[model samples]
Target: HKHLVQALRKAPQTAAVGFRQTVQKLAIVVELLLGDIPERAIFRQAPLRKALAPYFQLTQAVRLGNLQRFGEVLENFGPQFRTDHTFTLILRLRQNVIKTAIRSIGLSYSRISPKDIARKLGLDSAEDAEFIVAKAIRDGVIEATLDPEKG
Candidate 1:
């Protein structure tokens, strides 16, 4: 991603038209989605920040695990994401979304049932919640245990 940004920087000033800059912006979005770059890395640049406002919102949604806002952003920018070929990559952040939700749940409650977690995270089932919770624990996103008997 950095290399792509650098190459864009090296492009002749005459070629720095809207199209080329849009490509640069899309590349930056790809990097951000992959967690390969920080928001500040792009937002510090006024042009890129202004050009990529929608992507920034998407980033914010992902970070906060605001699945509703995430859906809104995707719905609003579906064409742009699809055009840039980032729709699938953005979809891959589901795990991060679930992890962020689990982290928040861990902080807010000492003990929560898999059923409650499933509902809170908008998951389809308690088993899915259990798998996500276990993954979150294994990934060090949260510290919790499952009580299958109690559940």
Candidate 2:
């Protein structure tokens, strides 16, 4: 189990893909390396799971497909966060989190404005929030009609 965690720490970093793909890769690693019969077995082991509880939460958040919860779990990771290649994926995942937040708002308000989404997401500017929403749409994670002039 220590070796399994070590392998996660040692995995090479690369440009991150979508959260679904990232979760799939992490699940595969846990299965292939740890003899975990089920794909999400790391989350099942109480001892090793305790040592890496935040990661377990991360997987849970990903599994639930809730970006808001993913952002909350990310806050729990705190300052001791790992710098492993896998960890870098969170930096990219954050963008998706932002997009998810936007989608949630859109669900409530069909013609929601970018500034409103930015305020809700706590982003620095409306432009950044709009950019994230656009990216999410481009990635096919969402379907939204952009209104640049209204924004």
For each of the candidates, the C-alpha root-mean-square deviation to the true structure, in angstroms, is 2.8, 9.6
* CA deviation > 4 Å runs, candidate 1: 8-20, 23-30, 33-37, 44-46
TM-score of structure candidate 1: 0.79
lDDT per residue for candidate 2 within 1-151, as digits (tens), equals 4554465555553433233234444553344233233346645544344445666666555444466677777676744245324555554555544545555666677687778777777678888878878888897767788899877
Where is the poorest 10-residue window by lDDT in model 1? Answer: 35-44
Best by lDDT: 1
How much is 142 displaced in model 2, in angstroms?
1.8
C-alpha TM-score for every candidate:
0.79, 0.56
Clashes of 1: 0
lDDT of each: 0.75, 0.58
